[model samples]
Structures are given as C-alpha cells and as structure tokens.
Target chain A: MRAVIAEDLALLRDGLARILRAHDIDVAAAVGDPVALAAALEEQQPDIAIVDVRMPPTFTNEGLVAAIEARARRPGMPVLVLSQYVEQLYARELLLSGAEGVGYLLKDRVSEVGMFVDTVRKVAGGGTVLDPDVVTGMLTHHGRNQAMARLTRREREVLGFMAEGRSNAAIAGKMVVTAKAVDKHINSIFMKLDLPLDADDNRRVLAVLRYLQTD
Target chain B: MAREDADRAALRDVNWRMILRLEASISVGIGLLMLIIWALAGARHFWPAWVWFGLAIPLALQVAIRRGLRAPKGHRLLAAHGAITCVLASILLAIWLLAGARHAFWPVWPILGLGVVLVGHAWVRHALPTAREQALADRVEVLTRTRRGALDVQAAELQRIERDLHDGAQARLVSVAMNLGLAEELLSKDPQSLTELLAEARSSTLTALADLRTVMRGIQPPVLADRGLEGAIRALALDLAVPVTVGGEIPGRVPVPVESAAYFTVCECLANVVKHSGALQARVDVGYRGGVLSVAVRDDGVGGASLAAGSGLRGVARRLEVFDGTMTLTSPAGGPTVVTMEVPCELSSPRT
Candidate 1:
C-alpha cells in the first residue's frame, strides 16, 4: 500500500518512512509541511496518510486540519494522526469524518513497532484504531457511563481492545483466552450498549455513531 | 418590615437637623427669658445683649462646622480651624463685655494664642492627604502586593518545572542512553538480552516523552492554543470524572496571559471539586460580558471550599489578582460550592 507522511521533524519523518518501507508499504511521498502535504495528496493520492497534529505555518493542528479537509474531499480517506498529547476534542473531530480508515495514536505509541505497524495496516484496510486515552476520552460522554458501567472488568478490557481495532483472534491472543470467549465478551458488550449485532468492524463504527448522536 | 425600615430611616435622617434647630430655639427662649428678667431688674445697662451674644455659641459652632464640611478637598480641617478661631474671638469679646470692659484688654492675650494655633493648623493641613491622593496610594499598594504575589507564584512555578524536568524526563533519557550503550555491547555476545535491553530503552524514551508532555501542559496546554478559552474549558470539562456541564459564550479571545491564568484557575477549582467536594456533579460557566471575562465553577456536594482553607485556591487567587482579577467563593455547608472569578479585558477580533 502507498502512504504519505507529513511530519515536520526530520528525524521522526525519516524514522516513520524507514519503518513503513521496512514493512513493504510504499512511501509515495513524505513531506515536512502541510503545503507540500496537500500537493502530495492531490497528485499522488496515496492509499493512506500519516500526519502529525502540529506542523509549520501556524504550528497548531495544521496537519489535523489538512487530514480532515482531505477526507472531506474524498470520503473515508485513510489517515493516521500522531501527536505528543492526546485530547478528546481532536479525537472527536477526526471521528466526525466517519470512523472508517482512521487512526489517532500518541507519538509514544510508535515505540511498539509490532503494534504500530499492525495499526497502520488495519487503518489502510478501512479499519479503526484509537489510542486508549482517546477511547477513554470519547467514552467519558455524559450518558455513556451507565451503559459502560454495566460491563465487567474483563468485558471492559475486551471492549477497549475492540475499540483499538483488534479482531476476535487478536483480542483472544492478547487476553490469553479462547477465541469463543472473546466472542462471548464482545456479544455481552453489544447487548449492554443496546446495539444490534452486526459484523465486528461495523459495530465499532456504530459504537462511535451511537454516542455521538447522544450529544 | 419595609415600612419599619422606612420609618427608622426617616427618623435618622431628620435627627441632626431637628436637634440643632431645637437647641437654637431653646437658646432663643433663654435669651428672651433673661431679657424679661433684666427688664424686671430695671433694663438700663442692656445686659440682655450679652445674653444674646452668649446664646450665639451653639449656632455659631454649627454654622462653622457645616461650612467646614462643605470646604473643598484638603481645606476641610483648615476651615474647621478658622471656625474655632472665630468662636474663640466671639467668646472672648462676650467675656470682655461682661467684665465691665476693663483690665487692659486681657482677652487680647488669649486671642493672640488662638491666632497662633490657627496659623499652624492652616500651614499643616495642606500636607495631609486629599481624597485623590488617598485613592492613588491605595492603587499603588494593590500594585505592589499583586506584583510580589505574582513573582512568588512565578518563582515557585519555575522551581517546580525545573524539579520535574530534572527528576522525570531528563533522568529517563539518561537511562535510555545507558540501556542503549549496554544493548550495543551485548549485541555480539547475547542477542536475546540485547533485544530485551533495546525494548526497555524504547519504552523509556516513550516515558520521557510522556513526562515532557506533562511539563509542557503545566506551562501552556497545546489544546488551549488550538482553541481559545471557551473551547479549552470545554475540552477540560470532558476529561473530568464528574460530569461537568460547561455553559456560556465568548465572542473573541482574551489575551494569552489572562487566558492561561483563567484556565489554570478553572483547573484548580475542578481538581478541588473532584478531590475534596464529594460532589456527584459539577458545572462551569464562562462568558465575556461588559468587557469582563467571568468563569464560575459550581459543584453539588458537601460545601465549604475556601481560599483560606487551601493553598490551591490562594494560589489561584494570587494568579488572578496579577491581572486585576477577582475570585469569590460561596460554599455554605451541606450544599453547592461555587467559585466565581472575573477579569476585565478587551478582546481582539476573532481570527479567521
């Protein structure tokens, strides 16, 4: 898969490009600023883009806005946002462009190379990935607490992993449990949230949509 | 209740004038009664004239004091001194007349003494404070105190940041470097241990970054920069454990320093709400009205939050006072606690 990266820091930009290249994903264009980033998105139209939250020319949320605008032009355009800090408002803004093919992770998460690359691949494949802080941020909405409070500690863990875009097998592997157990936990979570049973990926998107409507 | 207050106020309002007028009339009656006595005694020397002059004392003092009160700014006391001199001269003249106008003008000696005192008083009265000077001195006092408080808060904040960086991120980075150096040494002999060290170093760097983020947030939150005060407050309300309903509107951004001060105050107040107030719910209201930015945080719980009770709020008040701001708290026991803070500032036009 082809990808574009827009990070102002040269070391991190080069590091990201190297990591994606090592994973056999083509780095179509890696630019340092949003201007070049916009041009690259228009010309190359890569399958996915990894953008930083802060960038040059008013170094506040430039890359975030660029990503949102790009997705506005092309619905569900895959983009993974990286930032030094995790804020719920930014997460919600990114989710507003439709939860599919989007990821928002703290810059620190890149240290977990295996998980970071897996998240990139999942996001490029039209799946969702959210930082744990970001998930907690969205879940802190007013009325969601009652429904989420009904979940057991283990079910909550499974729910968190699900929100992070892990499949049933992946969650079972992480939790050291059988795949059927993971399926049962997810079913229980869905019942508690009062959501219709659907495919796993669709349910993740609906979870976000359901809470967003409450506000 | 209202009628009682009105009647009491009416009584108080007329008291001074009524008392003065009644005394003057009684003095007149005494003068007339003495005139009748003198008339019965034979009325040749006109001794009633002395009685009228003596009766003039209270009326004369009243006139003099009324004029003193009406005297312009610094001249009130001097006017009062001038009134005393007049009263003294009049009394001495009356005594001289009563003394059969003899003994080498003895009243002149005492009158000279009065003249000396009046001159001294007039000379010193100008040096005393006028109303405007007193007001300016009060302003200067506030400026001095707030400046010192601000410096103290700043010094304490700098020390905290320095200590946090020294102990947290910088130490982590040093450990990361040490681990990396050891990992390189083990790369040839122990490949498995080498991988473990590398993993540890990676996590250490991430922790260092986290520590740095915390320090940077203490300085100035990036979210506050992304969105101004109102939006920043909303973002803060979301992260809180208690459900905080943030209400109100801000048309344009306040100055950055003021915004920072106001934001941190809200943060401190909300922290208190979570920690001390056994509150089930909290609320924040932010609005800019009449060139003043006001923020009030309220919680429904066991009340009694006070600046004197906690250094957290005292520091908050000190920070706000630097900008000529004010903070008021109303946290009666067994009820809701509300902290209201306000700062007067002009807003620049909103950025497009």
Candidate 2:
C-alpha cells in the first residue's frame, strides 16, 4: 500500500514513514504542513494519507481540515488522523465526514507498530477504525441516554467493540467467548439501540455510530 | 500612614485649644470693660449689663462653633453644624427677650435662614463620598472581581490536569498493560512473534513516561519551580524555533501563584510568536518597579495579533486578570508585535 504522511514534527513524520516502510507500506510523500500535504495528495493520489491533527501555518486542526477537504475532492479517500490528544467532538466531526475509510487514533498508538499498521491497512481497505479512547468517551457520554440504558453491560461491551470496527469474530477473541455468543450479543445490541437489523459489519458499525452521534 | 494621621489629629487638637484660650481671654477683657463702664456711668440704670450680655453672646457662639468643628468627619460634621446653628438661634432669642419683647418676633427670620443653610450643608456633606472612602470602595470591588477570577482559573487548571493525566499517561499505561497481557497469552504458542510483542510493550512504557513528563510540565514545570520566572522563560526561549532574547531581572521570589500566572502568560505569548507571528527573532523584557511587575514580549514578524483573533492571548489575559493584572497588545499590520503585561504585587525581600 502506498501512502502520504502529513506531520509538522520532523521526528514524528520520519518515524511514521519509517514504520510504514518497515511494514512493507510505501510512503509516497512525507509533507510537513497542510499546504504541502494538500499538494502531495493531489500529485500522488496515494492509496492512504496518514495526517496529524495539528500542523502549520496554523497548528490548530489544519491537518484535520485538510483530510476532510481531501475526502471531499475524492470521495472515500482514506485518511488516518493521529493526535497527541483525542477529543470526542473531533471524532464526531471525522465520522460525520463519512464513516468509511476514516481512522482517528492517538499518536502513542504508533508505539504498537503492529496494531498501528493494521489500523492503517484497515482504513485503506474502506473500514472505519476509531481509537479505543474515542469509543470509550462516546459510550460514557451516551451511556445514560434512554436507548443506551437498555443495553446490558455485556451488550454494551459488544457495542463498544463494534464501534471500534471489530468483526464479530474479533470481538469474540477479545472477550474470550465463542463467535456465536458474540453474534447473539451484537443482535441484542442492535435491538436495544433501536437500529435496523444489518448483517454487513461495516454498515452495522455505521448504523450504531450514527445512532450514538444523534442527540 | 498611621503616624501621619496621628500627627494631623495632634495638630488639630492644639489649634482647637489655642482658639479656646483666645476666646476666653477676649471674654475676660470684655467683662472688665463692662465692669469699668458700670462703675463710671450712673450705677442704677445698669445698661452695662446689656453690654455684658452682648459680649457673652459672641463668646457662647464661638465656643459652640469650635465644639462643632472638633467633631470627627462624616455625619459628625453635619451634627456639629446643626448644633452651632441651634446655639446661635438661642443667643438671638435671648438678646430679643432681654431688649424688650419685640412686637413682630424679628429673630424668627434669621433663625429660618440659619436652618436652611444648615440643612444644605448637611445634605452636601452626606451625599458626596470622601476621597478615602472612594478609594477603599474601588479596592474592594477589585478584590471581589479578581478573587473570583483567581478561583475560576485555579479550578480550570485543576480540571485540565485531571483530564491530561487520564487521557495521556493513564491511557498509555493501560495500553501497555494490554500489550503485556497479549504477549503473555502468546508466549508458548507464538513464541516467534513474542519478541516483537515484547519490544512493542517496552516502547509503550517509554511513550507512557513521555506522556507523563508532558503532563507534569503542563501542571507545574520543574524548571519553573527551580528557577524563577526569568530563568524559566529563558529556558523556554532556548527551545523555540526562532531565536529569543530574554532580558530581565526578577531580584527576589514573587509569590508562587502570581509567578505561575505570569510565567504561563509569557509562555502563551511566546507560543503565539512561534506558531503565528512567524518571527525571525523575539525579545522578552521583565522588570519590577513601584510594586508593579511588567513583562513585555516583542517579535519582529507579520504582526496583526489580537485577543479577538484567537483564544491564545485572550486566555493569557484572563489568567493575568485573575491577579488584577492587565495585558496590552500593539500589533498593527505589517510590522512587529508587542505584548505588555503588568501585574501589581509586592515581592519578598531580595534573596540573600
């Protein structure tokens, strides 16, 4: 997979590029600012773009804006945003842009090279992968809502993994349960959340996230 | 100030005593003249008694006026003035009675005038605030506003610290624990990938430490606690992309709260200089004079910075305002930007 990286810090930018290269992912361009990032995205049209949340000329959400703009120009363009901190508000924004081909994770997650590489690939393959912190924040914020209150503790756990873009089998592996049990929990979650029954994992994840994002 | 007030009170007392003595001496002289007139003139008619009464009237009025003047400021002054008016009216009535009963009661007009004057004086004195009272009231207002602002800033700082710890280092450590758990699960079955998992877990620990250090710096920079504001700022300036010249002397330790607020305000300004101003170079000047500590940050850059433009400087201003401090920005377009912040506070004695 070929990718473009936009990170203002030279150290972090080079480190990200090196990691992707080690994972057999080609970094087509490594740019430092939003302007250059935009230029590289247009010129290279790489398979994925890993962007930072803050970059010059304004170090406040410029990278996020660039990523959204890139997807606007080319729909379903995959972009993984990494930040030192993750805000629920920002996660809502990135998802609102479109759930497909989107990822938001903390910069520290890069230390887990295997997981980080897997997340990048998952996003590039048109799957949404939200950081666990973002998912936890959303659940905590919406846990008291009437619809969410109906979910059991185990079902809520299943829903959280679903929002993190985990398949039923993956959730089962994490929870140390059989895939059949995971499927049952997911069906229960869909019913409790008042979401339409959908078997496709991506569509189900989107439906669950859209429900959580509503008022 | 206490000693000065005491001296003023003593001088007033001495003046009052001298006036009393002078009035007594004058009354004595007038009495002697009246007695001489009674001895020389036909002694039976006693017209000299009228002269004696006339002299006593003025002596009585003088004593009353002096007593009125001696009362302390505020309502007492009005009270004294009222007393003097009443005494003078009584003296007028006495003179009228001693001269033969007046057909029209003529002293009533003068008494009415005096009453009007006394009422006017009382109203004026009661309505306007004294200079000292106004100053104290203003100080109270400032204390109330700044006290509330300080509490708000403190609470916000604490909340931010809590959030940073929870989201930064704490979250990273949890991830590290998860990685270790996964490594343990795979130890015997997937021993080949165990090495990579262990390395990742170790790296996670280091990242957690880095996150902790960043959070600690946000709370209270160790450098700032070790060195004063000047030294701390100098250390900060060294790390900036653009060269920053820090020129200042903070001779003694400032109260820790004020020092922290000042340090953060300066840091915010410098961060603006780096992130927005696009300056090639910057300068910082710090000084304390007349109980006011002032810091000026100047950068030669694109300029046009303002509180309304971004929350960065506005946050700084709010932080300073918690200490009754002020921030002034002079960043016209196409030139240098200068931000001057002043906080009035006393410093401890110079460190030995």
Estimate TM-scores for all models.
0.78, 0.57
Model 2: pairs clashing at backbone N, Cα or C within 3 Å: none
Find the 10 residues in a row with the least total lDDT in model 1 chain B. Answer: B122-131
Give me the runs in candidate 1 sitting further than 4 Å from their true place. Answer: A138-146, A211-215, B1-125
User: For every model in order, what is the iRMS?
Assistant: 1.9, 16.5
Compared with the true structure, model 2 gives a TM-score of: 0.57
What's the lDDT of the predicted structure labeled candidate 2?
0.81
In the range B27-80, model 1's lDDT, one tens digit per residue, is 999999998999999988888887788789778888787667667756787888
TM-score for candidate 1 (chain B): 0.67
Clashing pairs in 1: none
